[model samples]
Target: MRSVYMQSLAYVDANRIYSRIMELGEIGRTKQSGVQRLALSKEDKEAQILVTKWMEEAGLTVSHDHFGNLIGRKEGEKPHLPIVMIGSHIDSVRNGGKFDGIIGVLGGIEIAQFIYSNNISHAHTLEVIAFCEEEGSQFNDGLFGSRGMVGKATEEDFQKKNDQQVTRFDALKNFGSEIDPARYKESVRKEEEIKIYLEMHIEQGPYLDVNSHPVGIVNGIAGLSWYTIMIEGTPGHAGTVPMNLRNDPMIGAAKVIQEINEICSSQPDQQTVGTVGIIQAFPGGSNIIPNAVQFSLDLRDINLTRKNRIFAEIEERLQAICQENGLSYTIKTNIELDPVACSEEIIDVFTSIGKKLDMDIPIMVSGAGHDAMLMSEITDIGMIFVRCKKGISHQPEESATKEDIAMGTEIMLQAVLQYI
Candidate 1:
């Protein structure tokens, strides 16, 4: 294939990208054609193996860090200079869409492949990463790999459990990971080591599609928080226990979950949103009053102060509701991230490149958390959003046109060229 450039404008073979996407999507495919490739699972490992092979085919040296992050690097003339990094996560949520995070990884690899095959020269080392556990679908603390890379993930974070009652620590161990609490820093990248982070992803929202734009420049990412709610009560026979005399933890959990919806909907900021991902009741029998209940809450907002303030009210409401139900509960915060803005300088670069390519690049906001969010801790970050069909994501129906994928990939390539 020829280099994807016409007089310095970015271009690439979208068929190659789409073909690889379909190949990878075959792994962990659900009956509905969605993906069930949770982090640290066999499927996730299988994905790593396949993508690693592709990385090698692109003539990049590949390495896996202690945190399970896959890094593919090609040294530049000035190898000592901070690297230009590109990528997104490969892990998927249960029954997730095929194009959500897959395009970014494949697109990044295509860029490296182009650089290698065309013998493009640059001054800074180029790296492409496949970050692990960004979905947090299994472990519940998302961005585990990126967090670890920046020294933000802790031993406790690795020890988190999934709905199957499997601790992530044990899962990682079973998946062939040798994690030592003391050695976590080994995966960390110092601020000076990273010049900037670039990610290409499906918009996961309707903005670009509805606006009839093929690609978007992300200006900011919404702040998000994940919490686990554990409620305790006395278990009793459903038939024998009178409603007034029984302490039902399930009842308490219901109230708190409902209040989350109520509070988020009532918030003056329409962007504030909350969702319950998983809920489990102990002694889950039709005839038994639940003695324990555990559930997770996902809350997001672009406004930090307002989100925090709303969370406080929700906390008090949880306490009051639990007391009313004659129950006790604890809400443990799993992860909390403040809103992060993309680098303005990089945004300008993208805008300028878009103009040069004669492509309309819409500026937008990302409501989802990404590896790019955590990478912002160590360096400037930028993102390219491809328009997905109907702006749908995280579902089997999630999709993006090849044209949009090509547009987004070109933006990523141009950004890399500018940085290098």
Candidate 2:
């Protein structure tokens, strides 16, 4: 293929990128055409091997850090300059769509391939990374790989046990990785060694597609918190207990759920969102009143203070409801992630390139968490989002057209060139 330049960078091969995406999707192929390559699973290992091979074929040197982050590096004219890093994770949730994290990793490879094939020389070295586990589907600890790289991961973090009683340390050892808790800090890259970080991902929401835009330049990632609530009450026979006399926990739980919705809806900030996704009632039968109910609550906002304030309101209302319903409750927090803003300098690069390419690119906030969120701690970070069909993700139906993927890749390549 003849070299096509956008300013000074060569246009990425759309066909080559799409083909590699399909190839990676086939590794953990589910019956429904989804993926199940949970982190450190056999399938995840296979996918890593394949990606490593592709990186080598693209004329990049491949290496793995103590934290299991796979890195591929290409030397630049000035090896002393800080490296320009690009990448995303490859691990998938159970039966998740193929495009969630695959696009960014493969897209980075495509850029390296373009550079190598065209003999383009850059000033700073380039590194493409395939993060180990960003979905947290396995250990329920999201951003595990990037967390290690930024020196945010603790020994306690690795001690967490999954549902099967498998600790993260054991899982890594089982997956053929060498583990030394003492060396985790050594894996962290110094702030001065990284010039910038960029990741290209699917929007995972319908905003861009609905607005008829092909690209989304991310402005920030939302902060999120998860809680498990349990309500306890007395159980009685359905036939024997009168409706007015019975102490039903489910009733209190229902009231709490409704109040949660109200609090979130009444928030002046439109970016705040609340969800109650999981519910379980004890004595779940036609002839008994439920004595206990357990449910999960997810709260998110781009503003950390606003999100915490909303959560406080939820707790206050929930306490009142429990007292009125004669039920006792307990709440436990599972996860807490702070909001992160994207670098304005990198955002300008994307915006400038979008205008030159004649594409309508809008600056937007991301409601989802990514490796880029954790990477923000160590260096300047930016993101490019492609349109996904129906804005659906984490399921079998998650999708992005080849044309949109190609567009995102081109924008990412151009941004890298400009930055380098």
For each candidate, the alpha-carbon lDDT, in order, equals: 0.87, 0.88
For residue 109, model 1's alpha carbon misses the true position, in angstroms, by 0.6
**What shift in Å separates residue 331 of candidate 1 from its native position after superposition?**
0.9
Compose the digit string of candidate 2's lDDT tens values, residues 1-420: 333344743377888888988899999999999999998888999998999999998889998776778899999889999989998999999999899989999999999988888787788899999997898888876788898998888888788887789888777766655545447788888888899999999999999989988889999999988788999999999899988997899999999999999988987757888999779989688788998999999899999989999998999998998899899999988777899999999999899888888766999999998899889888999999999999999998998989899999999998887666
Off by over 4 Å in 1: 1-7, 161-182
Q: Write the per-residue lDDT of candidate 1 for residues 301-338, one digit (tens) a residue.
A: 99999999989999999999888878898888889999
Strongest candidate by lDDT = 2
The collision pairs in model 2 are: none
Clashing pairs in model 1, backbone N/Cα/C closer than 3 A: 4-11
TM-score of 2: 0.91
